[model samples]
Target: MSSAQWNAGQAHGEAQAKTEEWVKSAQNTANKACDKMADSRESAQHGKEQSAGFIQQGAIDGVKNTLGINEKK
Candidate 1:
Protein backbone atom coordinates (compact mmCIF):
# COMPACT_ATOMS: atom_id res chain seq x y z
CA MET A 1 0.00 0.00 0.00
CA SER A 2 1.08 3.58 -0.63
CA SER A 3 2.30 5.57 2.36
CA ALA A 4 -0.46 8.15 1.79
CA GLN A 5 -3.09 5.42 1.84
CA TRP A 6 -1.73 3.97 5.05
CA ASN A 7 -1.69 7.37 6.69
CA ALA A 8 -5.32 7.99 5.70
CA GLY A 9 -6.36 4.64 7.14
CA GLN A 10 -4.59 5.32 10.41
CA ALA A 11 -6.16 8.75 10.70
CA HIS A 12 -9.62 7.33 10.13
CA GLY A 13 -9.10 4.67 12.75
CA GLU A 14 -7.92 7.25 15.29
CA ALA A 15 -10.91 9.47 14.58
CA GLN A 16 -13.29 6.55 15.03
CA ALA A 17 -11.75 5.62 18.32
CA LYS A 18 -11.99 9.17 19.62
CA THR A 19 -15.61 9.39 18.55
CA GLU A 20 -16.50 6.17 20.36
CA GLU A 21 -14.73 7.29 23.49
CA TRP A 22 -16.59 10.59 23.47
CA VAL A 23 -19.92 8.82 23.07
CA LYS A 24 -19.24 6.59 26.05
CA SER A 25 -18.18 9.53 28.19
CA ALA A 26 -21.30 11.49 27.22
CA GLN A 27 -23.55 8.54 28.04
CA ASN A 28 -21.95 8.09 31.43
CA THR A 29 -22.46 11.77 32.22
CA ALA A 30 -26.10 11.62 31.16
CA ASN A 31 -26.72 8.51 33.23
CA LYS A 32 -25.25 10.07 36.33
CA ALA A 33 -27.30 13.22 35.82
CA CYS A 34 -30.48 11.19 35.43
CA ASP A 35 -29.76 9.24 38.58
CA LYS A 36 -29.17 12.43 40.54
CA MET A 37 -32.42 13.93 39.28
CA ALA A 38 -34.32 10.81 40.26
CA ASP A 39 -32.87 10.92 43.74
CA SER A 40 -33.86 14.57 44.10
CA ARG A 41 -37.39 13.82 42.98
CA GLU A 42 -37.72 11.02 45.49
CA SER A 43 -36.38 13.21 48.27
CA ALA A 44 -38.83 15.97 47.40
CA GLN A 45 -41.73 13.54 47.45
CA HIS A 46 -40.71 12.27 50.86
CA GLY A 47 -40.45 15.81 52.19
CA LYS A 48 -43.95 16.57 50.94
CA GLU A 49 -45.33 13.47 52.61
CA GLN A 50 -43.71 14.37 55.91
CA SER A 51 -45.06 17.89 55.73
CA ALA A 52 -48.55 16.60 54.99
CA GLY A 53 -48.42 14.29 57.97
CA PHE A 54 -47.45 17.17 60.23
CA ILE A 55 -50.31 19.27 58.89
CA GLN A 56 -52.81 16.48 59.47
CA GLN A 57 -51.61 15.98 63.05
CA GLY A 58 -51.84 19.69 63.76
CA ALA A 59 -55.37 19.83 62.39
CA ILE A 60 -56.39 16.95 64.58
CA ASP A 61 -54.94 18.62 67.64
CA GLY A 62 -56.66 21.90 66.82
CA VAL A 63 -60.01 20.19 66.52
CA LYS A 64 -59.59 18.42 69.81
CA ASN A 65 -58.58 21.63 71.53
CA THR A 66 -61.65 23.44 70.18
CA LEU A 67 -63.86 20.65 71.49
CA GLY A 68 -62.34 20.86 74.96
CA ILE A 69 -60.95 17.35 74.62
CA ASN A 70 -57.38 18.27 75.37
CA GLU A 71 -55.57 15.26 76.74
CA LYS A 72 -53.44 15.86 79.80
CA LYS A 73 -49.79 15.57 78.84
Candidate 2:
Protein backbone atom coordinates (compact mmCIF):
# COMPACT_ATOMS: atom_id res chain seq x y z
CA MET A 1 0.00 0.00 0.00
CA SER A 2 1.09 3.57 -0.59
CA SER A 3 2.31 5.64 2.40
CA ALA A 4 -0.43 8.25 1.89
CA GLN A 5 -3.15 5.58 1.97
CA TRP A 6 -1.73 3.99 5.12
CA ASN A 7 -1.51 7.40 6.80
CA ALA A 8 -5.14 8.15 5.96
CA GLY A 9 -6.29 4.84 7.48
CA GLN A 10 -4.39 5.52 10.69
CA ALA A 11 -5.90 9.00 10.98
CA HIS A 12 -9.41 7.62 10.57
CA GLY A 13 -8.80 5.04 13.27
CA GLU A 14 -7.53 7.69 15.66
CA ALA A 15 -10.56 9.91 15.06
CA GLN A 16 -12.94 7.04 15.71
CA ALA A 17 -11.21 6.22 18.99
CA LYS A 18 -11.40 9.82 20.13
CA THR A 19 -15.09 10.02 19.32
CA GLU A 20 -15.81 6.90 21.38
CA GLU A 21 -13.89 8.27 24.32
CA TRP A 22 -15.82 11.57 24.20
CA VAL A 23 -19.18 9.75 24.13
CA LYS A 24 -18.27 7.75 27.22
CA SER A 25 -17.18 10.86 29.08
CA ALA A 26 -20.42 12.67 28.23
CA GLN A 27 -22.50 9.73 29.47
CA ASN A 28 -20.59 9.66 32.74
CA THR A 29 -21.18 13.38 33.27
CA ALA A 30 -24.89 13.06 32.57
CA ASN A 31 -25.21 10.19 35.04
CA LYS A 32 -23.51 12.19 37.74
CA ALA A 33 -25.84 15.16 37.18
CA CYS A 34 -28.91 12.94 37.44
CA ASP A 35 -27.66 11.47 40.70
CA LYS A 36 -27.13 14.92 42.17
CA MET A 37 -30.63 16.02 41.15
CA ALA A 38 -32.15 13.00 42.87
CA ASP A 39 -30.23 13.76 46.02
CA SER A 40 -31.40 17.37 45.97
CA ARG A 41 -35.02 16.28 45.56
CA GLU A 42 -34.79 14.01 48.56
CA SER A 43 -33.24 16.73 50.65
CA ALA A 44 -35.97 19.19 49.69
CA GLN A 45 -38.69 16.72 50.61
CA HIS A 46 -37.12 16.08 54.00
CA GLY A 47 -36.95 19.80 54.71
CA LYS A 48 -40.61 20.23 53.82
CA GLU A 49 -41.61 17.44 56.19
CA GLN A 50 -39.59 18.96 59.03
CA SER A 51 -41.13 22.39 58.47
CA ALA A 52 -44.63 20.94 58.50
CA GLY A 53 -43.97 19.22 61.79
CA PHE A 54 -42.70 22.44 63.34
CA ILE A 55 -45.73 24.40 62.17
CA GLN A 56 -48.12 21.79 63.50
CA GLN A 57 -46.43 21.88 66.87
CA GLY A 58 -46.62 25.66 66.98
CA ALA A 59 -50.34 25.64 66.22
CA ILE A 60 -50.98 23.18 69.02
CA ASP A 61 -49.03 25.32 71.44
CA GLY A 62 -50.98 28.43 70.42
CA VAL A 63 -54.31 26.69 71.01
CA LYS A 64 -53.26 25.48 74.45
CA ASN A 65 -52.05 28.94 75.46
CA THR A 66 -55.24 30.60 74.28
CA LEU A 67 -57.35 28.25 76.38
CA GLY A 68 -55.05 28.57 79.40
CA ILE A 69 -55.03 24.76 79.41
CA ASN A 70 -51.57 24.53 80.95
CA GLU A 71 -51.42 27.65 83.08
CA LYS A 72 -48.93 27.43 85.93
CA LYS A 73 -50.51 26.68 89.28
Candidate 3:
Protein backbone atom coordinates (compact mmCIF):
# COMPACT_ATOMS: atom_id res chain seq x y z
CA MET A 1 0.00 0.00 0.00
CA SER A 2 1.18 3.56 -0.67
CA SER A 3 2.00 5.90 2.28
CA ALA A 4 -0.37 8.51 0.78
CA GLN A 5 -3.31 6.09 0.92
CA TRP A 6 -2.55 5.14 4.55
CA ASN A 7 -2.33 8.83 5.59
CA ALA A 8 -5.69 9.58 4.04
CA GLY A 9 -7.31 6.68 5.93
CA GLN A 10 -5.79 7.85 9.23
CA ALA A 11 -7.04 11.42 8.69
CA HIS A 12 -10.55 10.20 7.98
CA GLY A 13 -10.62 8.14 11.16
CA GLU A 14 -9.49 11.09 13.24
CA ALA A 15 -12.17 13.31 11.73
CA GLN A 16 -14.84 10.75 12.54
CA ALA A 17 -13.74 10.47 16.16
CA LYS A 18 -13.83 14.27 16.55
CA THR A 19 -17.35 14.40 15.18
CA GLU A 20 -18.56 11.77 17.65
CA GLU A 21 -17.06 13.66 20.59
CA TRP A 22 -18.79 16.89 19.52
CA VAL A 23 -22.14 15.13 19.27
CA LYS A 24 -21.85 13.73 22.80
CA SER A 25 -20.98 17.16 24.23
CA ALA A 26 -23.95 18.77 22.55
CA GLN A 27 -26.30 16.09 23.87
CA ASN A 28 -25.10 16.61 27.45
CA THR A 29 -25.67 20.36 27.19
CA ALA A 30 -29.17 19.88 25.82
CA ASN A 31 -30.11 17.44 28.58
CA LYS A 32 -28.99 19.87 31.27
CA ALA A 33 -31.00 22.68 29.71
CA CYS A 34 -34.11 20.53 29.64
CA ASP A 35 -33.65 19.59 33.29
CA LYS A 36 -33.34 23.23 34.33
CA MET A 37 -36.46 24.15 32.41
CA ALA A 38 -38.47 21.42 34.12
CA ASP A 39 -37.32 22.53 37.54
CA SER A 40 -38.29 26.13 36.81
CA ARG A 41 -41.73 25.07 35.63
CA GLU A 42 -42.39 23.06 38.78
CA SER A 43 -41.25 25.88 41.03
CA ALA A 44 -43.48 28.37 39.25
CA GLN A 45 -46.46 26.10 39.56
CA HIS A 46 -45.90 25.69 43.29
CA GLY A 47 -45.63 29.45 43.70
CA LYS A 48 -48.86 30.00 41.83
CA GLU A 49 -50.65 27.53 44.06
CA GLN A 50 -49.41 29.33 47.16
CA SER A 51 -50.55 32.71 45.82
CA ALA A 52 -53.97 31.37 44.97
CA GLY A 53 -54.39 29.97 48.46
CA PHE A 54 -53.54 33.32 50.00
CA ILE A 55 -56.03 35.13 47.75
CA GLN A 56 -58.78 32.68 48.62
CA GLN A 57 -58.11 33.11 52.32
CA GLY A 58 -58.27 36.90 51.96
CA ALA A 59 -61.63 36.67 50.22
CA ILE A 60 -63.00 34.48 52.99
CA ASP A 61 -61.77 36.87 55.61
CA GLY A 62 -63.32 39.82 53.79
CA VAL A 63 -66.70 38.06 53.73
CA LYS A 64 -66.50 37.26 57.45
CA ASN A 65 -65.65 40.89 58.24
CA THR A 66 -68.59 42.17 56.22
CA LEU A 67 -70.96 39.84 58.08
CA GLY A 68 -69.70 41.10 61.49
CA ILE A 69 -68.55 37.60 62.43
CA ASN A 70 -64.99 38.84 62.77
CA GLU A 71 -66.05 41.40 65.43
CA LYS A 72 -68.14 38.85 67.33
CA LYS A 73 -65.15 36.55 67.51
Candidate 4:
Protein backbone atom coordinates (compact mmCIF):
# COMPACT_ATOMS: atom_id res chain seq x y z
CA MET A 1 0.00 0.00 0.00
CA SER A 2 2.23 2.87 1.19
CA SER A 3 5.81 3.04 -0.11
CA ALA A 4 7.27 2.90 3.42
CA GLN A 5 5.23 -0.16 4.31
CA TRP A 6 6.26 -1.89 1.08
CA ASN A 7 9.97 -1.16 1.79
CA ALA A 8 9.66 -2.49 5.32
CA GLY A 9 8.14 -5.70 4.06
CA GLN A 10 10.93 -6.14 1.51
CA ALA A 11 13.58 -5.66 4.18
CA HIS A 12 11.95 -8.21 6.42
CA GLY A 13 11.83 -10.73 3.58
CA GLU A 14 15.47 -10.19 2.78
CA ALA A 15 16.50 -10.69 6.40
CA GLN A 16 14.54 -13.92 6.63
CA ALA A 17 16.14 -15.21 3.44
CA LYS A 18 19.60 -14.40 4.70
CA THR A 19 18.96 -16.12 8.00
CA GLU A 20 17.69 -19.24 6.27
CA GLU A 21 20.72 -19.37 4.01
CA TRP A 22 23.09 -19.15 6.96
CA VAL A 23 21.26 -21.92 8.80
CA LYS A 24 21.47 -24.22 5.81
CA SER A 25 25.15 -23.55 5.34
CA ALA A 26 25.89 -24.27 8.98
CA GLN A 27 23.89 -27.51 8.84
CA ASN A 28 25.79 -28.68 5.79
CA THR A 29 29.12 -28.02 7.48
CA ALA A 30 28.06 -29.85 10.63
CA ASN A 31 26.88 -32.85 8.63
CA LYS A 32 30.18 -33.11 6.81
CA ALA A 33 32.10 -32.93 10.08
CA CYS A 34 29.93 -35.64 11.59
CA ASP A 35 30.54 -37.88 8.60
CA LYS A 36 34.29 -37.43 8.86
CA MET A 37 34.25 -38.22 12.56
CA ALA A 38 32.23 -41.36 11.96
CA ASP A 39 34.66 -42.52 9.31
CA SER A 40 37.59 -41.93 11.62
CA ARG A 41 35.89 -43.89 14.39
CA GLU A 42 35.27 -46.80 12.04
CA SER A 43 38.90 -46.83 10.96
CA ALA A 44 40.05 -46.81 14.56
CA GLN A 45 37.74 -49.70 15.37
CA HIS A 46 39.16 -51.72 12.48
CA GLY A 47 42.67 -51.08 13.66
CA LYS A 48 41.78 -52.17 17.17
CA GLU A 49 40.27 -55.39 15.85
CA GLN A 50 43.39 -56.17 13.86
CA SER A 51 45.55 -55.53 16.88
CA ALA A 52 43.45 -57.86 18.98
CA GLY A 53 43.75 -60.58 16.36
CA PHE A 54 47.48 -60.21 16.31
CA ILE A 55 47.66 -60.49 20.10
CA GLN A 56 45.55 -63.62 20.08
CA GLN A 57 47.77 -65.21 17.45
CA GLY A 58 50.83 -64.31 19.42
CA ALA A 59 49.38 -65.95 22.50
CA ILE A 60 48.67 -69.11 20.54
CA ASP A 61 52.20 -69.16 19.18
CA GLY A 62 53.59 -68.69 22.66
CA VAL A 63 51.64 -71.68 23.95
CA LYS A 64 52.86 -73.85 21.10
CA ASN A 65 56.44 -72.82 21.73
CA THR A 66 56.15 -73.56 25.43
CA LEU A 67 54.77 -77.04 24.69
CA GLY A 68 57.69 -77.75 22.31
CA ILE A 69 55.44 -78.08 19.29
CA ASN A 70 57.17 -77.55 15.93
CA GLU A 71 55.57 -74.82 13.88
CA LYS A 72 55.28 -75.44 10.16
CA LYS A 73 55.83 -71.80 9.39
In terms of TM-score, which candidate is strongest?
Answer: 1
For residues 1-73, what per-residue lDDT tens digits would candidate 1 score against the true structure? 9999999999999999999999999999999999999999999999999999999999999999999897945
Model 2 lDDT tens row, 1-73:
9999999999999999999999999999999999999999999999999999999988888898889995545
> Would you estimate the TM-scores of all the predictions?
0.95, 0.88, 0.90, 0.87
The best-first sequence of candidates by TM-score reads: 1, 3, 2, 4
Q: Which stretches of candidate 3 lie over 4 Å from their true place?
A: 71-73
Candidate lDDT (C-alpha), each? 0.97, 0.95, 0.96, 0.96
lDDT of 4 by residue, 1-73 (tens): 9999999999999999999999999999999999999999999999999999999999998999889894856
Name the regions of candidate 1 deviating beyond 4 angstroms: none
Clashing pairs in 4: none
User: Which tens-of-lDDT digit does each residue in 3-66 have in candidate 3?
Assistant: 9999999999999999999999999999999999999999999999999999998898899999
* Model 3 RMSD in angstroms: 1.7
- Candidate 4's C-alpha lDDT? 0.96
How many clashes in each candidate?
0, 0, 0, 0
Clashing pairs for predicted structure model 1, backbone only: none
Model 2 residue 36 distance off true place after TM-score fit, in angstroms: 0.5
Per lDDT, the best of the predicted structures is 1
